[model samples]
Target: MEFNLTWILLGLPVAFVLGWLASRWDLRQVRADNRQAPKAYFKGLNFLLNEQQDKAIDAFIEAVQNDPDTSELHFALGNLFRRRGEYNRAVRVHEHLLSRGDLSRSDRDRAQHALAHDFLKAGLLDRAEDALRRLEGTAFEAEARLALLAIYERSRDWGQAAAIAGKMQQAGQGDFSTRLAHYLCEDAQTRMAQGQFDAARKLLEQALATAPQAPRPLLELAQLQQRCAQPAQALDTLENLARQAPASLPLAATLLVDVAQATGQQARVQGLLETQYRQAPSLDLLQALVALDQHIGVPDAPGRARLVQHLDHEPSLVAAAQWLQGETLAEEQYHPAVQKALDHAAKPLTRYRCAACGFEARQHFWHCPGCQSWDSYPARRVEEL
Candidate 1:
């Protein structure tokens, strides 16, 4: 107001000095923050390497507070929460990362994948499935698909499993033909259980066509054919199975006998069994032959002799148990107890065992119940294995 030029010039330098001081203060504050964040991060790393998870988590929390924009810190914290069984916290952390608009594409995909794992670990299958589905077409696509396949299998959703498997197959992930065939066979079983025999047969046929070299579908189709009163067709299927997967004939021997009897092709089936036994010398084939002998009223001594001859090949306790059942020991009174003990010992050997998990079952399985592995259980019994 006074129009003093001297005072105006002095005021300009004062303002410049004040502005420089403010800038220095702000720079110091930022440098302090950067130094503190690294110190906290390094402390967390040290704690983690020392296996002190609780203290490490606390240090990481401090780091994250210092550098709230760090996505890697968030991921580390989320993974730690998951590993510590704090799935809810892990989910929240990952979800927060996903909600941020500034996240990179790869980081967002990572967050989604981590969230899905959290849901899966928490046993929230539906939520896990949804999260996993969002990861499709991302870098995690194959992993997501595999996890989805496991979920579908655990839920017995064979149709969904098949669809995922088909996608993976088309993607050239691996040869899923055997797995796809398993899904079809599983669906066929469900159809059979619902008394939809025609549909079941069609599914089994499709399974066979999908993987002709696979033994599971062939065995299932043969059994289904036998159940449908198509004895001739059943015999033909079993015959085809014997030719294609001769190693799996033990799994189908009893069915083959039944089919042979139903179709009055006993001699042909017996010939097939004899030929198979000569090639593989399976106890099951011998059992089927003995069954055939009994059906025709052959003398008991010959069956016992046949079992004795089996000792020349594989020294099977089961065969010895069978042979002892017909043998007249010196002490006939002790025969019952001896045979009972031997039979009991051999019964365990007759059970099928999963090669992968070592879970044993009285019946053979294409899919292992213990470890959820497909084709883990061999067609042969524990004794043969």
Candidate 2:
């Protein structure tokens, strides 16, 4: 074949031009893909900022499909799913991230934490507990422990709660002494209900040793002692409570009066209560004092005088009603109706109320039944507060 130099020279430039055009087409395609991904991502972000979560979720799904390798996009999608109550989808996303062997250690922990949260939100307590347990040695240990504590508390698993609280206390998270004591007291209550008196006593004793200054253990132990027919020991426990936790005396005043009468320690109790009343004249303590005076054969007139004295200090309607119940009114027939109305009005004022949740109860509670908050109710009654 004869060589054509002119044709060969023309064909070389044509081939070069074709190659350049192909390269330009590939670059433009890549730029378009990149632009589409960001556009979807920004659309999602705009939706989120506008609080349009459903629309944001759709946009994020589009962005994730366009950029499947982006871990942060996966996380955002998972969080959005969780927020929208799509817990199963959130679990799937986090589990996919966790399955990626190329994920960093920190990212794996984060994925695990997110998965635990998904389980929690889904009300899958067992799965949530397992996932949280796996985070024990991670930087999320403290947070995981706290969540576990809440779970245990909600489940009424006091032993587990105490163990986690002990760990958190050891880590210097905060002072969990009172919380630990409460757990012990709760456990003791369960044991007592099961007719395990000895075990219950031991648990309460341990609780007192754990937090000597905590009022609950002392009060619970005194009740246990009285139940065992050891009123003298119960009186001693209540005396210790009065000394260690004077602010909690009103809650224990009725118990004190009972134990004192049982143990023949009315004089001692009367003096202690008088001293406390001088410091903080609570209605409960005053009522106890009156009951004690009646028990010890004090004059009725003098005993009724105490309620009038309390009215001088607190301007309490409850006190006025109590005082009038024992009075000789000018119109004796009308007195009964007036006293009945006064008592009816003052009944609610005698109820104890939770300071945290405003839950009212006829009796004082160491823990709020409504909010599950410990020590949320003040010792004082509604009228006193």
Per-residue CA lDDT of model 1 for 184-255, tens digit only, reads 999999899999999998998898889989988878888887888898988888888888989989988899
Task: Provide the global lDDT of candidate 2 against the true structure.
Answer: 0.93
Error of 1 at 144 (Å): 1.1
TM-score per prediction, in order, is 0.91, 0.91
Candidate 1: regions farther than 4 A off: 1-26
Q: lDDT of all predictions, in order shown?
A: 0.91, 0.93
* Worst 10-residue lDDT window, candidate 1: 296-305
Q: In candidate 2, what are the lDDT values of residues 232-263, reduced to their tens digit?
A: 99988888998999999888899889988898
Model 2, TM vs. native: 0.91
Which residue pairs come into collision in candidate 2?
none
Best by lDDT: 2
